[model samples]
Target: MATRISSSFRGLILLSFFAYLCLCAHEAEETTETQHHHQISHTIPVISLIPSNACTSSAKGSERKASLEVIHKYGPCFQSKNYDEKVPNHLEILLQDQARVNSIHSRLSKEYSDNNKSRDSQVATLPATSGLPIGTGNYIVTVGLGTPKNDLKLIFDTGSDLTWTQCEPCARSCYSQVDPIFDPSKSTSYSKISCNSSECSQLISATGKPTTLLLYLRLRIRYKYGDGSFTIGDFSKDRLTITTEDVLDNFLFGCGQDNEGLFKGAAGLLGLGRNQISIVKQAAQKYGQFFSYCLPSTSDSKGHLTFGNGGVSSTVKFTALQTLSQSQSFYGLDLIGLSVGGTQLSIPKSAFSQEPSSIPARLSKVCLAFAGNRNETSIGIIGNTQQRELEVVYDVAGERIGFGKGGCR
Candidate 1:
């Protein structure tokens, strides 16, 4: 009897040892895979915190308010500033708008002169189709008017409000940022809209300008340095090209002035917002109801952008966030919960202030109050000032949820 018992015990021990080995192997495999896909750029010094339920747990009425205070006292929002130096830099709203319009008009005027003044006959360049396939969520879309259409490299921006590109109009003497400008003459589909048209007047109204303003399109325009400094030229009825199985016809886009020459080479911007005829909305109006984006993990240092029905990826689970649609389309996630390590972050909805301003103005400059932390969440923008798409992806990448730059009420 004793000999039989010993044999059984040895067999059990061997089985347990094998199971343990298998578990360790599985864990190591997971770690290796994660390491292979990780992307790290400039190190973001972060404050380590133990999450708390007092802040993260859902509360009702007055109890919720008290829980938020406890969260602010202990949450990372208090210590986040110590780690991230890119605090939100708020700019006055009026000043920003003024800078945008001024930049556009000045550059457009120059491009007109340069193009029309060229005495020699020159063949316009044709646009080359970008061979990249649109990824599931994040992708870049280049738009232009003609053959060799000055291809504008545009990051489809959801977090930003104003969508413009660099232009030859302003290139007259400004710092050359990107590549050559988009020319309309070569495009067989290009058609210009009159300044007297109702559409022109409507565009002015949205920008806080008068109806008399002459609006033109350049290949690109950008909002930079806390101002609306854009480079634009004349508009055209161009059939925007896309790589999709569906028929895409009669797409409206602008031809940037190649004369001013200020662009750093980005083609132009494709605005995605709630406005009447912005890029994303226009596509959604014609295509499907859902539009998604995926930012390559900045940790990897490389990413792609996609648009239209063709741009959806299966890699990451998408958590649809709330969005504000006042001045433009802004993304948001329900402030249902926040966890810092093991601790939950407590924030009060009462502290949030929702106001109408440029999307960029809100995200990087607004100040909101946190419990123990006087001001929390200094949102900073990353990537090209021309890349509005990166902003949305950045916001989504971090533990920080919601969109817009502002202070708690």
Candidate 2:
């Protein structure tokens, strides 16, 4: 009995010692991680762009006009129209949302397909579209570029990576824009990249096309939209002014010499994709691979785009981001179960699977599968449907996305 008691005491002591060692190691690891995060935060700069005054100056007027137009064209229950039909005023605006969702789905599917295939295999061409619309949506931001600072109102797009605007010396092609076209020659900071440059190499890798020699030293890039709109221009770098006080120099963007299709009153696109050249990726040093936006439902209302960790709220419920091997530019989420009212739906987990080739069609119906309130205005489509209801948070650092109700409202 005495020997048995002594053995039990020894076992307890050994366990306690091991626990202490584990606790100490965990604490040390946490401390190191905290210090590394601190260092990163100090190094990267944060940029926040709000809905510009120009966008909100006549908010009521625009909202009323937009609402009236939507009701007249699509009525209470919006239905998809034929391509040949003249673009309705409100439908044109809403089409931006549709285009964005489609672009994201296409890119993600392509990325997934590429990853599953073996190396040295020819990549299949996926039908991808540029999300650019003829005019600006309610979520517009004023961006200043060049030496004297040419402020241009641009549509903020998370689905794309290349930021571009119509430029002067438009001998080739230029659309009638509300704002003045950007002239690279006027800006002392403007410089065209060469085909042999590393930046051009990266562009080639992304688009799978060689850089075209447009002018004497200008390297050209062709951007094709899913809607058949395409822009061909010089890929150059210049200073971009986000706010009155904050300016990002040598910002890489396309100087569109020849632009066509429906790019209405807006000047260009502000890309916030996951690529290295995207606004999010370029500012990763400051934002730490994270950004969030709250898209407003009304045309008159304003939405915000925040960089880094400032936008995440404590109330948001997060789900792990679905990581794909090929497409790092998209934020994919795994949706296990969906609920309607108090009862969970009987939908299969595989129904929401994003298997690249099967996702685009499955995603459109995933929302409908719940059979919730059919009268709900936001349904059928992915972008406007989900965004209008939930305050979607992209936690890039954590590799997760958080969805919460009433945050946007």
The candidate that wins on lDDT is: 2
* Total backbone clashes of candidate 1, pairs 3 or more residues apart or in separate chains: 69
| Reference-based lDDT, residue 39, model 1 | 19
75 Cα displacement, candidate 2 (Å): 17
TM-score of model 2 relative to the true fold?
Answer: 0.62
| Worst 10-residue lDDT window, candidate 1 | 10-19
lDDT digits (tens) for residues 1-409 of candidate 2:
0111110000000000000100000001111111100000011111111212222222222222111111111121212232122334545644654454444345445656765664431211222345454433334556789998997866665545778889988857887665788999999999988766777666655554423422225467677666666677778899987655556787888888887874555577777765667776666675577755554443334445555565355666765565434355545543222344434355432454444454346332233222221222211222343343244566667776665554343
TM accuracy, model 1: 0.43
Please provide, for model 1 over 42-105, each residue's C-alpha lDDT reduced to its tens digit, 9 standing for 90 to 100: 2221211123332221112112111111112122322323232221112422232223323223
TM-score for all models, in order of appearance:
0.43, 0.62
- Give the lowest summed-lDDT range of ten residues in model 2: 10-19
